[model samples]
Target: MWWDIVKVLYIATRWPWPVEMGRQRMIVQTLEFAATLGEVHLLSFGDPPTKPAPDFISSSGMLEMSGLMGIAGSMLRRPLLPLQSHLFLNGPATAAVMEAAERIRPDVIVFDMARLSHLALAIHRHYPGIRLVLDMDDRLSKRYQRMLTNETAGDLGGTFEARLPGAIRFLVPRLKKLLLRVEKSLMDRSERRAADVFDAILMVSALEADEMRTDCPGRADVVAFPPLINELPVPQQDFSRSVRFVFIGNAGYAPNAEALELLDRAAVQVSKNTGSSDTDYCFQAAGKPLAHAVYKKVEVAGFVPDLSAFLAGNAVLVAPILQGTGIKTKIIDALEHSVPVITTPVGAEGLGLTEGEHFICVLGEDDLAQACLHIIRSPEARGGLARMAAAARNKGLTSQNRTILRDRLTFAFGL
Candidate 1:
């Protein structure tokens, strides 16, 4: 760890106070990591938290946002900019950030995600010598491209929908594939723009870091930052009776919505394939649901407060993630909690874990039900695998990795 850190001005498109959801958590984690390097002052969009922060993490800055009309104004004025980049473009926001920058004279300005890449580029233009960074949590282009190929989408729920203007929000669910293709193309350009401009680019996956390096060689410093997990008590074990088959994720997310459907199909297959007449293994689900999707023989709990407690023993995290780009944070949660998991190669991507040794990895979607049966039938094996996975996962989170990450960030900032 460094003894000193550069004073940083961190910016985010989302208001990350009172972290409750997945994206919120990611934003907060990024802020916290930035703080580790030096004093941080945060600037973000979205309404300020109605409640006081939960005394977790914080920054002092005004909350500024672009209304629908304001965004439309930006689009008309800046015809050359991509349609999606307009979401974060605001004249008032730039003015406020410029005011803050002049006052603080920060060593580095960190922007979160490609949505803010252009904004960051503009900010860096005014202060050319200051190091600039883009903390892209996931490659949106890769995610959207996969969404198109798989044709997987659903209502992104109120939380995500609120970010869009009225017409875009209304049209998005109706025209999922078309909008995704557009977003995919625009994001591909945004990715390249960020790669070309920023002094450093932060990605959540190692493979993505290498890809970016190869695509734009010697353009910028690129490094992979592991997903930051909350420090919570390890979930208590409970391996008894019929194992609780579970799936966790925001169903508003297209990939997760598809995964829930896959879980249901696997459950149906289990009923038909099982010799017993009563193949009544009712599955449990935690997280938001789709706008309209029925869960057959599954107990759906929408957005549980205590996830670790809910994911108690006899609970197997079944993630049939057929599409998506970044590491599945939910799978990591299960591994950390010592909960057995049944997933596919896509589900287990990026996370350096062995196939059979860590978690049960199935080949095809059809093999999902059978994998669940295997985990259910062998209680001893499931427990052993979960324990081993947890051990290896924690073991990898060592000082050496931290030292390497610290060095990369430091070098990127030219410290």
Candidate 2:
């Protein structure tokens, strides 16, 4: 008889398969890493009814105690659940994950985000010996607090719909601020308690790990584990195209939506300044919709089937994000495709890209327009930037990086 492989269960608050956004990228990467070790079991909630299945044997929250609990939790949590889902908690999702964990009795349990730490709490209560890992995607409580503070400080600007004058505009921000404060307090306590219970608290960036260390002090072990992107299956090259610029991301996101608006404005100014009426230069955007004026020069591709092909066809990728947290995976995907990039300083954060070397980094609107014009006008400069991006891609997302992550996981779990 064949001996059964040691089982590892991954609990996600959102659908992990059919990778859509940056968080999905993390889930897919984690699944790939876990597959290399043992039989990996997946349990998820909060996806649409018809979301595609994962490669592994999986269970959905369509008809089960966990599923019902998830639905109820979503209803009760209301607006909070959507934001909470990002951290992997949301009430119903966690309940389903807990039920799955108890049934599976896996040797190790990994919670993809802090919101899902509740499952770790539940697991420790029943199966104390099982290794527990909390993958802190970011310092979430701090981020929420930052948002609250920004809103209160009037630094959020009028662009945010939440700042508009209405019942929702007035009530929602106040409610969100109150809820975020309460959630932050509860989550901070939960993190400390879970840190004592779990084997490792894995953070996405060293800066995040440092913040956690400050919070817990000498109580728990924390490790920085940045996200990993799979190596490109194709060769890198600067695709020869007529200066087409691309920006790929979920346009529904406020930062990305704002960036697109800003880019459109900058593009118009650049066109007027250069006295070019012809649509020789195009700005192609991919992903979900946003509230912005569309122009003949702008093409909204809306969620391309193949991102690599889209990037390869464009001359440069532009990211003019003014706000947000976490590493920008769009930048990584662009670099992976060896596409030259023009971005704001905020867009290039955590990637360790050198200014004017790996990509062009600009600060103001005028600078941004000028940078775009310069890149579009100079083929030699674009080529050089593309070469640098390709090199950065290899250094950032190689087989070696994956191996290092595998080893780190092994050590963290004592596998």
- For all candidates in order, the CA lDDT equals 0.72, 0.65
Clashing pairs in 2: 70-92, 89-115, 287-303
> Per-residue CA lDDT of candidate 2, range 49-90, in tens?
355656664443431223334434554664443234323434
lDDT (10s digit) by residue, model 1, range 1-415: 2465567887877777665456666666666666667777777776676654333234456546767898789878876565667776888888888888888888888887888877777777898878888888778888777767775544432255767878778877787777677777777777887877888887777777888787756577897876643334666665544667899987877678788888888888776776652223458789877767897766788888887787875577888888877778887677656677788888878777778767788865578888866655665755575576566456435421546656656666667
- Alpha-carbon RMSD, each predicted model: 3.3, 5.5
TM-score of 1: 0.87
Worst 10 residues of 1 by lDDT: 51-60
Q: Candidate 2 — what's its lDDT? A: 0.65
Off by over 4 Å in 2: 1-4, 47-49, 58-99, 145-194, 218-220, 233-241, 276-279, 291-297, 398-400
- In candidate 1, the residue pairs with backbone N, CA or C atoms under 3 Å apart (3 or more residues apart, or in different chains) clash, namely 238-313
Which candidate should be chosen as best, given lDDT against the real structure? Answer: 1
